[model samples]
Target: MNGNGTLIHLDNIYTAYEGAAFPVIRGITLSIRAGEYAIVGGPNGAGKTTLLESMNGMLRLTHGSATVCGLDVRRQGCEVRKRVGYVVQSFFFDPLTPFTTEQVVMMGRYGLLGCLRRPGEADYAAVDRAIRLLGLEDLRDRPIGTLSGGQQQKALIAQNLAKEPEILLLDEPFSNLDLCTRDFVSGVLKDLAKKGIAVVMVSHAFDGLPDGEIRIIVMRDGTLSLDETCRPDEVESRVRKASTVQ
Candidate 1:
């Protein structure tokens, strides 16, 4: 964490995709502290996912600056990624893929283990902890491709947990999950936040929000339109109102 306890700091940042005519997100400034639960919401083309990519240094900054985990995003993107975990909005694994759940989870440690080093006992322990945390113990040996969408989502989340990131950026994590599973995953995220891991998610579903105060950041036209702290029940309405306004 930084000296001020801010894990993510973006100052007037602008990010653009390759060969794009202009930046996808522009003049955006935001900060997130450790243990805070923040939701990013907006209409379909509001650049919510682009914001996540900018936070984790996945996209190049075209202007201004970004710092995550106390490292400069543009200058230290590779290092920044090591301490921040990102779960993308969509992924499809081929059914014929041969990796097991455990193996998939273990892959998260590869960044720390590097190319030549083997996974040590500590690595295995971390993988085990992640699997248990995600309630995937019974399915640890099953092929990842064979699991249901919700199960696969859990495994992917577990994989990121194995990395033990200080910040977790999830883009619509509840998309594949059913009602019960959404609640279950929300509880897990709540626990993670309580343990001091920053959770910033892009989501449309607000029914299963974790208890207590929450932060809502709404975007429109490639920039933040609304940002405030509110109750869980007020999130959807606030976002809806912000999104519909001219």
Candidate 2:
């Protein structure tokens, strides 16, 4: 992809934990364009999570550079984070914390409103829209801790969308979901991409994607091994290839 007009650009990146013998990610480069839906797949310990973190500036690059939406993620970390909504592999909540589903979803707007400003009527409306969009109305007033795993994931996604971010990053979003919920969430992501939001998802499974323009990135041994446009038979072929390599 063209990095100049891309929403995300990583060039020759290297990242390592302090005092570690080997780098977690080494000399990786990739670009994702606006409105693109891409999936990163690999075996365990392939740096898929690390690459996603670099996109949002959560992990500092030891070398090379990363830019998101034309902003240098390292130099403009806060700004980059504001435009990207990240959903991690696990959703954790304190059992006693009293945040309702609506309240949790409304948190997405905090980045836009900033810490000093309070959520106004418009912000609340946006939260409502996001909740309705994600079909979370029945659970809107429920305590977050009481919801099921799928419901919690939907709430997390709703929270991210409420921010109206330019890009969405999901790491193993379907890991804990049933098949039905996985399909539903996958459709939601496809809808978001159609609305012009760039989406980069990390998944081991790449089945049932919408029939449209999409991209795939394969990661292995802390490097981006393959990046290409998605084709009809691509997923199965990649899966077979990855299986053989392992």
Candidate 3:
């Protein structure tokens, strides 16, 4: 821990999708500090994704509160999102989509550019850095939809990185990657953590995790059942046991 204080704070939050009568997640309380690597795990429909959405201000908090990067999530959603990078679990791009890989990555900086502001040299530099970080230089000119699944995933990650966010939230990041690709991506995330970027991932697969202590959070139904720090090797077992209702 870096003793830099909390980066994400959720105090008894309850969130629900619009038009849904019942909230999907409730009574959720958590605190995450800077430079921490956290994994959210549980069975299907375990509210894992909902928790991530709440943190990013995608879902409205029906009760309680949430703060990310010291900005109030409810009141400062636009500001929070500007600083938080989120990669969705699954996405499909139409084959004819006109955006090139570089263009898509540049979209990440759009929030910061704001209305009437164009991307300048510094923005281009950031995009180039992110593309190189994900090893996507060769594919930068290719249409995003034309790339393979693994390549597209890398592009998506690069896009988020272009924003220079303090926190990176990934949902099932390895879903489209193979064993070798998973290893590569894991190492990439680990390196980002070393640079003090908080990497919070929601995933089901436990293999190919980065080395070091990991913060494991297991959610069941709509509430957190376990939150603990453990060695990477113990994560699978701990999550498996904690996911079951006690």
Candidate 4:
């Protein structure tokens, strides 16, 4: 709970997983404001994903404070999650899974609808807008599981958009996407940022970043090594310089 314009604020926080021996990240502090495009990069096991989860309130903090969208991450995790869209690192679906792309996207509205209530006109409108924004209109009725991995990834993003999140946390979202799709998705992210949606992404692929200033955060040994703003083209080099293993 700090900084009015800051969408995510973590102050001297320590996060650990269930039954873990010790904390994965410690004494962490960072602030991300709206309309910012941030790229988190580091060597493997450097707590990049952990930082994203911490911001999304998906992990338990053993110490310090984490606030997202003006709510306490520790005490108001559910509310925090509602305003933050988190696209995880890995996901796949069985080909026979029954839900269509549209149905899956509508699931984002479930949290807001509450118990025993169905999606109303406004909810459906939001879903439709999200689908169209992601260019998934052609795949709206297709079974989500039957789509290619890249298509499925795009659908996942559209699903999050349907929630109308103030901030988006994406972990290697382009891993399944090729160069062309990466460029298109990069444009989509840039547009979201321009519209005042904070985009925090963790990715090694840096060839398709947008043409603007990008905030680069680097992690090392579960600690923040660097935090700076540079041109989009400088992200990879800065990450390399800050990573411990490089």
Candidate 5:
């Protein structure tokens, strides 16, 4: 692929926890093109989560360089984050502090709106659209903490999409989801990819994805062990083999 299509570029990256004997990611280099659906797979302690965090500037790079949409992650983290959407595995909100689902979704737009400015009509419209798209109309006015796990996850996705980001990052989104919910969210992601939003996800279930072209990366011993672009069927076989070996 051409360099122009590259949205994420990592060259010789190294990251480690303080006082740790070894780096969590070592001499890693990879690039994700625009509109590509990619997944990172690894056994436990292989730095899959750390790699994702470093891409979004949640972790400081100990060595080498990372660029997202042509912006240096180390130097332009805030700017990079503005164009990127991140969905964590879990939501952490005070259960006692009541906030409506709609209100929680609106918070995504607040970062783009600035500290002093209040959300206007367009912002509210976007929030409503996100809620409707995620099928949260009935739960719109309900307290966020009262929703089920799947509903809460949908709310987080709605919040992420409200930012109108170019790249969406998801870490273990399907880990706690039921089979039906997992299929639903997977369909949503497929639609998002069709709309030309680049997606980079970390998941253990490689077989759950819909049939399409997908890029796969396998991590082992804190290093990139495999990187290939293949059809869904090819990816499944490859992933199965890799997982078995691990």
Candidate 6:
């Protein structure tokens, strides 16, 4: 962590896809601190997902630098990934995939387990804690592929939480959830932030934010348009206003 408890830092960074004419996200500088709940908002194709990838080193940096957990993002991506948990925009499992919800969540600890090392008591304990936190005890033994979309979403989150990451990045996590489920999931994320985990999420839905001050980041044309802290109730309007500004 930095002097101010900044857990993730990106300095004038540019990220590009292979063979792409230009960077997907350019000249982006961002800092996220422990126990923060930051929402990344923007119109589609505005580079919100790219920014999240840049922070976790999932994409190659074409220019500038990034540091997460005091490690160089480009050179130490493996280590960075261990400390960062990312839940993608969407995921699906075949009905016959065979992994149980408990098994799926246990996968999150694989990176830390190293090759040929099996999970010990600590690993199982962590997985149990995540499952309980996500209220997945009822579905723990069920085949992950058979769950409803919202159930699967909760399972995925539990999987990430099992990693005990310092930074958690989520992309469009609420896309498949109903209002009630959204509220439930939002509360889980809020609790994560309270526990000193940096929670950064990209989402279009704004109705389910927890009651508290939150950070809103709006992107436009691959750059930052707005970055500020505001109460949860003000987020939708502020993001909408910023996104519409020409």
lDDT of 3: 0.92
Question: What are the per-residue Cα lDDT tens digits for candidate 4 across 139-204?
Answer: 999999999999999999998999999999999999999888888899899999999999999989
The TM-score measured for candidate 1 stands at 0.98
Candidate 2 clash pair list: none
In terms of TM-score, the best-performing candidate is: 1
TM-score leaderboard ranking: 1, 6, 3, 4, 2, 5
Per-residue lDDT over 22-55 for candidate 6, one digit per residue giving the tens place of the 0 to 100 score: 9988898889999999999999999998899889
**TM per prediction:** 0.98, 0.93, 0.97, 0.96, 0.92, 0.97
lDDT of each: 0.93, 0.85, 0.92, 0.91, 0.83, 0.93
Which 10 successive residues of model 3 have the least lDDT summed? Answer: 1-10
Worst 10 residues of 6 by lDDT: 204-213
List the candidate 4 regions with Cα displacement exceeding 4 Å.
Answer: 1-4
Give a tens-digit lDDT track for model 5, residues 164-226: 878899988887678887887888888888777888998877666757789998888788888
Pairs clashing within candidate 4: none
Per-residue lDDT of candidate 3, residues 105-184 (tens digit): 99999999998989999999999999999999999999999999999999999999999999999999999998888888
Write out the backbone clash pairs for model 5: none
As a TM-score, model 6 comes out at 0.97
Q: For model 2, give the 10-residue run with minimal summed lDDT.
A: 237-246
Question: Lowest-scoring 10 consecutive residues by lDDT in candidate 1?
Answer: 205-214
lDDT of 1 by residue, 95-213 (tens): 98899999999998998888999999999999999999999999999999999999999999999999999999999999999999999999999999999999999999998787888
